[model samples]
Target chain A: MLGSEIPVFMTNRNTITEQYPKIYLYRRIVQAKLFIDANYADNIDLDNISDEAYFSKFHFIRLFKNIYGKTPHQYLIAVRIDRAMQLLKSDKPVSDTCYAVGFESLSSFSGLFKRIVGITPSIYLMQQQKIKAQIKSSPLTFVPGCFAEKNGWLKNRNFRETKS
Target chain B: MLTKMTHISINVLDQDSAFDFYTNKLGFKVVVDVPMGADGRWLTVSPPDQPGFEIILTPVIRSMYSKETSETLRELIVKGSFGVGIFTCKDIFATYEELKAKGVEFTKPPTKEFYGTEAIFKDDSGNWFSLAQLT
Candidate 1:
C-alpha cells in the first residue's frame, strides 16, 4: 500500500485473465459507436452488443469520446437536437419538437437546447422564422447551398478498396 | 487512415498518483497499468464503459523521452497547450469539484467553450489533461 492510501485498482496485468485483445476490441469500439447511434434508446447491454464495443459501457463511452470528440450520450443528444431544430423550422410546436426528437420532457429538452445552441427553442424558432420570411420575400430558397467542392475526397475515400 | 487514437500520454512525476487521478478521480478505469520495462510503469486508462480509447498515464518525462523533449512537453503542459476539455462527463462542475476534492490541481477552472465546458488540471507529476464536457 502507498502512503496516500488509494490502492492499486488492478495491479496484475495477466495476459491470460479477463482481457480482450487490443486490436480486436478496437474495431468493435467503432462498431459500438455506430450501433449505439442507430439504437441509443434501445437496450444496449454489453452482452447483447455485437462486439466488444458494447461490452463495457464505460469503455465504449471513452473510446467514442476520444475518437469523435463527443461521448455517445452527447452524440445522441446532438442527433436529437438536430432533428428538433428541423422540426422547429417546419412550424412544429415546441412540445411536439421535443417529443419528436425523443425527449420525454419539454423542459429538459429546452435546457439542453439552450446549452448546445446558446438560445432557447423559442428564440431559435423565431430567428428561423424571420430568416425564412426574408428568404421567401427574396425569391431565393432558404436552404444554404452546401459549398461542397467537386473534390476527390469522396472518390478517394470510396475508392480505397479498388486502389492498388 | 487515422483510424485509431494510438494513446493519450501524460507525463507525471509518480505513476501511482497519476493512476489514481485518472482512475479513481476522473472515472477512468485502469485499462493497462502494467510494466513498461524493469523501472517504469505503462499505466493507461479509458472511460470505464468505453474501451476503444485510451490515455497512457506515461511518466514519459521520467522514461523514454529525452530530457530536451520532456522539457518541451512540460512547458506545453503548463501553458495549457492541450486544447479543449470535457470529454464525456455527465456534468462539468460536478466533475471539477470531484477532482478538486481528490487533490487534483487545476491550471484554470472550467472555461466556457463553443463545444462544451473544459477545465485544465495537472496530475500529481505535472502532466496536463482537459476535462471537457462536449457541446
Candidate 2:
C-alpha cells in the first residue's frame, strides 16, 4: 500500500542544453537570466528585465520565447520543478513543495511534475524515500567537496536551501 | 480589445532604405506604397500571408528636425536600451542563417531555448529584431 501521507518535493536539474554560443543572444539571455534568477519564484514580466523588452503579457511571452528559447512561464515552472525534485529527496511534502516553488494550483502542479519526471508525485516520493534509505545504509566515502549538484552554475541553487 | 497581432509599425530613418531592406533582405510582402498628403509620405509593406500587418516605412520625425534624436535613438538601439523587440521566424535557425548571410548585423547568434533557436539582428537604422525558429 502507498504511504499514509504523500511526501512533497521533487528533484532539480538545470542547465538546459544550449547548442550555440551566447554572443548574439547575450542581451536577451542576460535579461532572462536576470529575471529567472530574481523571480523564478515570484511573478516576473519582460518589462522586469528592461523597458525596451517588455510588451503586453502575450507579447512579453512571445518576446521571451524568441530571445530566451523558452517561454518565461515554462522556464520558471521548470526551475520550481527542479527545486521540488531535490526537496522530494530530502523529505518535503509534494503539495507544500509545489507552492514553495511558486505553483499555486495543486492539480496543475501534479500533472506537470509527473510529465517532467515520468511519474506521479506520490510515486516519485515513495521511490525517492526508498532510494534515500538504501543509500544511507550503503557504505560510501567522498572527497572534501564531492560537488553532488545539478545546475550549480546558477549559484541560486541556494534557492532550495532556505526554502521552507 | 483582444485580437491576434495583425501588424506592427516601426519608425525608420529613410523610407527607401527601409523598403529595400525589409523587402529584399527580410522578404516582407509589399502590399502598398501610396503617397500621403503634401510633404506626402509613401511606402508600406505587409507580410505576404498577413497583408493587414502593415509596416510604416516612414522616417523618424526627429531625424528630419535634427540629427540629435537620430543619434540618441541609434545609441539606444546599440545598447539594447530601446523599446520592445519584434521576433519573426518560422525556423529560427534557418532564418537566422539567411539573415546573417544577407550581411545583417546581429546582437547574437542563434541559441536554443526551451521554445526554440533564437537570434537578434539589427536593421541598418538600428531597429532590433529577434528572429525565432518558426514552430
**Tens digits of per-residue lDDT for model 2 on A1-164?**
35435332111112222444443343444455455745666655545654544446566666567654677667777767866876787789888888877788989889999998789877888998876554334212110112112212133323322432
How far residue A56's Cα lies from its native spot in candidate 1, in Å, is 33
In order, what DockQ does each candidate have?
A: 0.02, 0.01
* Residue lDDT tens for model 2, B30-129: 6544332221243567764467777656565421435687566556655666444655655454455456556788786765555555677787677777
Whole-model lDDT values for every prediction: 0.60, 0.59
Tens digit of per-residue lDDT, candidate 1, span A1-164: 47447433233212221122354454555565455545644434534553454456666667667655787677778767866776788778888888877788889999999998899999999987876565344311211122001211222322222332
Best by DockQ: 1
- Which candidate wins on TM-score? 2
Give the least accurate 10-residue stretch of model 1 chain B, judged by summed lDDT: B31-40
Candidate 1, residue A87: how far the Cα is off, in Å: 51
Stretches of candidate 2 off by over 4 Å are: A1-164, B1-7, B37-40, B62-80
